[model samples]
Target chain A: MTADTTYKVPTMAEMAANGEEPEVLFWVGCAGSFDDRYKKVTVAFVKILNQVGVKFAVLGTEESCTGDPARRAGNEFLFQMQAVGNIQVLNGYGVKKIVTACPHCFNTLKNEYPELGGQYEVIHHSQFLQQLIDAGKITLKGGGTFKGRRITFHDSCYLGRANKVYEAPREVLQTLDADLVEMKRCRTKGLCCGAGGAQYFKEPEPGRKDINVERTEEALATGADTIAVACPFCMTMMTDGVKNKDREDSVKVYDLAELVAQAYSL
Target chain B: MVFFEQILFVLALAAAGWFLTRRIGLIRRAILLGRPEDRSDHPGERLNIMLRVAFGQKKMMTKPLVGLMHFVIYLGFIIINIEVLEIILDGIFGTHRLFAPYLGGVYPFIINTFEILALGVLLVCVGFLARRYVAKVARFQPERHREMGRWPRTDATLILVFEILLMTAFLTWNASDSLLRERGFGHYGELRGTVGSFVVSRFIEPLLSGLGDPGLVAVERFTWWFHILGILGFAVYLTYSKHLHIGLAFPNTYYSDLRPKGQIKNMPEITKEVQLALGIPGADPTEPPAEPGRFGAKDVRDLSWKNLMDAYSCTECGRCTAACPANLTGKKLSPRKIMMDTRDRLEDLQRGWQKTGPDFDDGKSLLGDYITAEEINACTTCQACVQECPVNINPLDIIQQLRRYRIMEEAQAPGSWNAMFSNIENNMAPWKFSPSDRFNWADQLKQ
Candidate 1:
């Protein structure tokens, strides 16, 4: 087993060289790769995995867009072109049992990839984390930073409604001993963060209110200091929403993975 | 004199047939303008869907009270139309109550049943009129619903009033004919003393008792003519009104996308292109097109026949808009409006083609003039609209196509979207970083 003290994370290429197959393929999605804020969530998730000693490896440079944004943006040609390349690589690797930090990635890899013959048991990171906690592999230190704080989760449309993963994130949050509150429009009725359907990469068409702003208003109305999220896209939108309300100083946004990492003190 | 009556009846019949055939032909031609699609697979599933959704009114029953009210009118309309068959025979043969002699014991039962249904249809229509004007159902109200403008609202009211008038005419005809039979007047008395009597028509007989035998005959003839003419007119008017759902619900439900609501259809042309690019040897090679077509749909002709059919099938019910997250959150998108816009654009194209031959262009397409970029962009693709549409209209399909055209064909995407596209093309992701550094987030995973 790789030691937690080492800085090097295992790559699928290295695993192939060592004649080893990981128990799970950690698909560190695009946001995990480059977005500064989401990268922290990625790190937190990795740390929890390391503490649990679950064998996992990433594609590193071999990873590409799942083509979700392209498809959603109406670029079917570009999306298919991208999807074909990724499917070829994943199939070549003989990878299975994939876990992803991004719900968009989880959705595409699980739901869309099967059409292209790239099938795997795909799980969102919150689900994988919940599984580890359920199996007693992840043990959190008592009286963590979020022990008694009010935390309201903002459901990612892809995660909650698209995939029906409402319980996993809440289960992970429960480990931090936080007082979890509910938004008026939670679970299936959850609103979008104004960043879905490639909206993250575009200026919103002129409207009375951006969806994220309205969603954040609901999150704030719950009077929760910490707004929890499961998807990186939700993290970005909710952070922006909190900031738009000028509550970044008081009402902080966090991913469930980030809270897990903090609780484990890894 | 009998010969002249038969001649007049034959001429009226010919005129109604001509008008009905002409209207049906126009609709068929207009729908055929849409590109061909193969929705013929899964015949069993399609038939099941047609029976449940259209015949059984399953989707309509999601809202119980409204569904029951709608079912009453729908059932009444169909059942009462059985009387129209006999009227047609009478008109052609110059025989009063043509089927009564042949039906014998069953004739009165059928007539009594028709009388009851006619009353039901009339009462339901009045209730609907009150709901639209007095009770003001939010879906029908004009202020909040952008598509429920003057003509659409008036069209709904007009259909209701027309039904009421037709029912009145039928009841008047039956009551007058019954009175003439009691007075032993000519052919009317030949069908007298039929076993099952008209309960509702007997009550209405007093209202027409003052008309003498000659006057009663005139009244019966006028109403009989009016009833048949009104039925013919309604059949033609449906092609213009949102009431086209009355006819289209069967085919619309049959052709509904049977896949999971969240699953978007793959573009076949794009799939082939991708397979060819990846050096997959099995891709059937075909002659490259002389010129590439537009990336996505820009007008009604570019949409699939199913989509065009969906446009024709819309009930303007606003269930889709009510469930739309975008509309709920104050965005410009309204799924009902999307369908309305598609149908309007289709009609405009058909009208233009009719006037100027096949090579016609109004220069006003579905994208800019009818449905705006703001509305299309506002969609979150949540499938809530798709889930709520009673007839399985997929407005999201049209929205996606329009967005695709804006991005790929016109290159009119927002500046930030351009950045995302560039990022994906270069870095294989939507970020401004190299792929090698993707694992750096794992660095802090160590103690």
Candidate 2:
């Protein structure tokens, strides 16, 4: 799908200035905000949201990290600092519903934030897409670009085992009319992308192989032409893994949102 | 002679009961050493979970073959213990087959069922032993898993061998007693009549047929004593061995965390500090602020009681370690080892307390002395280990707590992590990007 240059994204600050409140606040996580590769995913998601006419506004510059990495790395001090800051911003807007494309952000905002007095009805993008599709708002083109293609969904640890949101992403994938295959370890037994617990920031402890490499091998073993992911961390790790095996030419990694956008020609 | 035998049986039973209770009490005390946690909520849900996971062995069924075999052994062990009740009554009253007269024809049917289960237990124990020693399963191998060192490996082997021996004695006692009934020798001949031979043990009868009536009585008496005494000894030994899971698994599964696995527990203490720092205003002015305790777990005592109970409940089955992404990738962090170390540290503290009262300091801690920073840091917080555990034990909670201690208390996080921490502190993200530019990605869409 070609990039839509005329799409104007609204920020929470701008919306509030107009005495407006969106149906849901889009939490653009650190990766979705700044990572070069993940920027495309953000655009694709925005395209889909705009096409569906969902009233969603971004926190924009007001958003901060959900402190998942800090908390997982055992720095509760830094974690609460970032968490409380974001919670205040979210509360200031009186955001009652939130949607994010990142599992780490989704997990923190949905589960961890409530205990810190930042309760919001949070849903991941995959679940949001599934909801849209279920509500007949997202009708795909029959036998579209991804029809009958082999697509394997890598279960992000935060999304699958951690939060038990296994079926929603796969439910979203089912709409593509694609052959959804599974890795040997999928769903509850899914392997990590080797980027959790702040492992993304540092070298892995000496091991026989990196966890992402091992997980990538599992995905490659499935022989799927396209790898579908819902989390940005999995996007980076699995993309690196596809590159490590030099299979970038033969295989492609796309976020669930990106796949939907491409299939819809949004 | 029967009176003397009854007295000996009573003495053995009393000693066994005393020691088992004492050991169990010690274990209870050790588990209680950990900090308080309110897992008491959701009683009805906890009971359902306990029933499904522990009683139903639901998670174990994920691996059908192993699960079926384990189910056989578990069912057999429980059913066979019913026969122990009969043995106890017969011992105390100096009666043979005490239930035989009360139940009439149904007694033989019950004995046959016990015999069949005993045979099943015997065979499954042998199969487990072979799986551990002969086939050398990867999870059970000391060579592959350092935590399966001499003591742990031997403890597993000993339990299996003990079960096999107990089953052997049970079957032999039944076989010889049935033979003696046929011969009309002593109590077996006088009291029991010709209540038909048990189904499984009848096959064993021919082997003891060559031993005459006197030899038959000797075999019957010897196996009867051996079977009951072995059961008594095993009951006492159970608290000291990894086999304690047979009992603790129920309570462990019952009190497990019901929250989403992604939710790392909120530190209210840290929250208060952060709220105060940010001037968020929730602290009560009327009450003097309590002194802040340790940030995270440095010792077993700092861990929640559920964590310590989880350690005691671990079967050391290595399912957690086997499924761990970090462990599979050859990292030093084995979820099973984390549990084992917590248990070992608790036991060490328990030993010290016993020697010099409860205040005794062992000068050892669970964090540094047993588990290393390298091990705790390797965890991906993936929850694979948590998912794989059949009894609902969570190794990730302990790993995170130890990681918290290392980073928050000792300030010993890795160099790159420190950099990431500072970056998040200043930039509101883990990277050194300006928060004002968080929406800069939108510029691409406007092109």
Candidate of highest DockQ: 2
Best by lDDT: 2
The DockQ-derived docking category for candidate 1 is acceptable
- Model 2 error, position B52 (Å): 0.6
Interface RMSD of each: 2.2, 0.8
Model 1 chain B: ten consecutive residues of lowest lDDT: B284-293
TM accuracy, model 1: 0.84
* Candidate 1 local lDDT, B1-447, one digit each (tens): 667878887887788788778866777777777777789999999999999988999877878988888888889888888888888888788877877778888888888888888898899899989998899988778787778899889899999999999999999888988898888789888766763237788888998899888899999889988999888878878888899998898899999887654556677777777788788755766847334366788888777788889999998888888767677666788999999998888788767878997788878889999999889887888766776788889999889989888988888777777888888888898878887777666666544
True contacts kept of 1: 0.56
Q: Pick the candidate with the highest TM-score.
A: 2
Can you write out model 2's per-residue Cα lDDT over B47-125, one digit (the tens) per residue? 9999999999999999998899999989987888888999999999998888888888888888888888888888889
Each model's TM-score? 0.84, 0.98
Inter-residue clash pairs, candidate 2? none
